[model samples]
Target: MQQSADILKLFEESAIAAGRVILDIYRAGAAVRLKGDTSPVTEADEAAERLILAALARHMPDVPVVAEEEVAAGRIPDVSGGRFILVDPLDGTREFIGGHDDFTVNIALIEAGTPVLGVVHAPALHTLYLGGAGKAEKVKLDDKDAVIARMPIAARLKGASPSALVSRSHNCDATDAYIRKAAILERKTVGSSLKFCMVAEGVADLYPRFSPTMEWDTAAGDAVLRAAGGMVATEDGAPLTYGKRLPGLRAFENPPFLATGRPSERG
Candidate 1:
């Protein structure tokens, strides 16, 4: 139990440190570049990844890391042991470039095909959300990285006309279909993993993604949500797993998945 708590602490510190780096670049604006996959990346992403990677290595050198920027550069680590960390130093790059507060720094620990822990930090929003060890919480941080407040959170029960969220950057036909088929009466379009955090904290009830995504994009928020009593599942209603490199599939690519504040809505 103590060991789990310690790793959770490491995730918090590493995420905050990375968020600070990202905020530095975010304030000054950033130069945009396209990765080989045609995704947007900025200096903040690279710099934060460097800082987070070093922190993780320093604390847990034996465990491998699968960070987005590093993977983009073809630096895949061996995570066959099914125990690894996933980092998206700067999620919602498009939103960040567009001067939105929805961008976040995401980190998660994946074990045996499950995300057992996660930390998602939105520096611009000055809010951090984390989950692990059978609980989840939201944190308010000051400019100096001091925790000003913290509170436990949990997923809400699904109600009539439960709210749903879609990605501001990645909404597509399949998502629209899900929203319609699910009879979503209220919906909000937001960016990054905040969708997951919102559901984990009872702010929203559902988030479904039928488009392409990397494991790092969802793992942290998935962990937090799960810890808060939420569930993330693929189209077949199976739990989402990490460290994927299947035949004819790009490594670490995620299947179309749905994230719900309550497990009752799995589909």
Candidate 2:
């Protein structure tokens, strides 16, 4: 129990430190470039990743790290042991590039295909959300930071009018169809895992990713969402699992999944 709590503390600190580093860069605003995948990559992402990676290496050296920037740079970590760190130093790269304060630094610990701990920090917005060890909370991190919200798993909804949180960047036809058919009323276009955080905090309702996403993209968010009474599940209604050992599968490419706050509504 102590070890779990300690690891959770490390995860939280790493996320907040990464968020601070990213916020410094975001405030200054640097030149942005596109990665080979045509996704945005900034100096903030690189620097924050460097900071967080070093911290994780120092604190949890035995656990391998699978970071987005490192994968993009062709340095995939070995996850054969089925336990490792999943990270997106800057999740909303496009929003960061576009000068929107909607980006996030995301990290999660995946063990045997389950996210046991997760942390997400929105540096620009000065907010942080985390979950682990059967606990989930949201902190508003201004100059004087404070825990503004404690998240609880949502109860069954009264109506079928579930709320939906969609990507501000990657909305697609499939996503549109899900929203329409799902009878989503309150639609929020939040970037990065903040979309997931919304459901975790009971601010928004559901999140459906009809488009492609990698395991790392949602692992941390899923952990927090699940910890706070939500879930990320495969289309077949199975819970989303992570850190699978596929010899040739890419590091951060995610499959289509849904983040639903109301598990009871699945019928």
Candidate 3:
């Protein structure tokens, strides 16, 4: 895209479009299956991913797409240039299948191993978060998914009584210890990348994820959080970068990390 605005519009539209398809399938009660990794998958995931891939192909022909379902199907594109789009058409398959509203459609642009733009859309909740070009925003949608309101958002500086956001589907002792060690005064359970959006909106101050996650699962939310003046860092306080392929590890695998609404020196 020539401008950041163009990228933002495309990301937002593409995410929302995929979300619409997901909702349609969700309403009809989709059948569930398992991927090679034993994680759950549904028709909504496949259908939404297909819709997102097509949209990206049409609008961002030059950019490579590393989408979840596509990767599972051995359809990975060449992202050697360090610039590509990461997509999780349905970020919270379990939540969706469980009839919860925490699932989302996620899209992000990674440049030089860092996300510069991102969009997260929750169709069931009619909520969206966009981040890029030094701006981060939360959008409210109507029943038909039309934008009803938009507000600028930014991360709040950490304070003494910081709150934490934890995952509903994947809970671990490591995360709990981190929260306890940090002395987090409050905690909330969330699914999908909505945890990152909540931090971006200043609703929470921290999100510590110790569970295994792929790049697509976190890229979009990471972008939004970063754009909102927040930070995603490894345990050592280093900025979390994408395009990772450590030896003996799966491609796009991520290390345990912490998410916070603090000023990121790396940014």
Q: Which lDDT value does model 1 have at 232?
A: 92
- The full ranking of all candidates by TM-score, starting with the best, is 1, 3, 2
Q: Per model, state how many residue pairs clash.
A: 0, 5, 0
Worst 10-residue stretch by lDDT in candidate 3?
258-267
Best by lDDT: 1
Total colliding residue pairs, candidate 3: 0
Candidate 2 displacement at residue 50 in angstroms: 0.4
Full candidate order by lDDT, most accurate first: 1, 3, 2
> Please, what's the RMSD in Å of model 2?
2.3
lDDT of 2 by residue, 1-267 (tens): 237678877877888888887877887877788889888889988998999999998888889899988988999888978889899998988888888888888899988888989998888777888887888878776554445554444423425566788899999999999888867677888788888888887767678898767777888888888888778887888888886633555545556788877566565
Task: Report how far off residue 121 is in candidate 3 (Å).
Answer: 0.3
Off by over 4 Å in 1: none
Candidate 2 vs. true structure, TM-score: 0.92
Q: What tens-digit string does per-residue lDDT give for candidate 1 at 155-250?
A: 998888889999998999999998998788899999999999999999899999988899999999999999999999888888889998767668
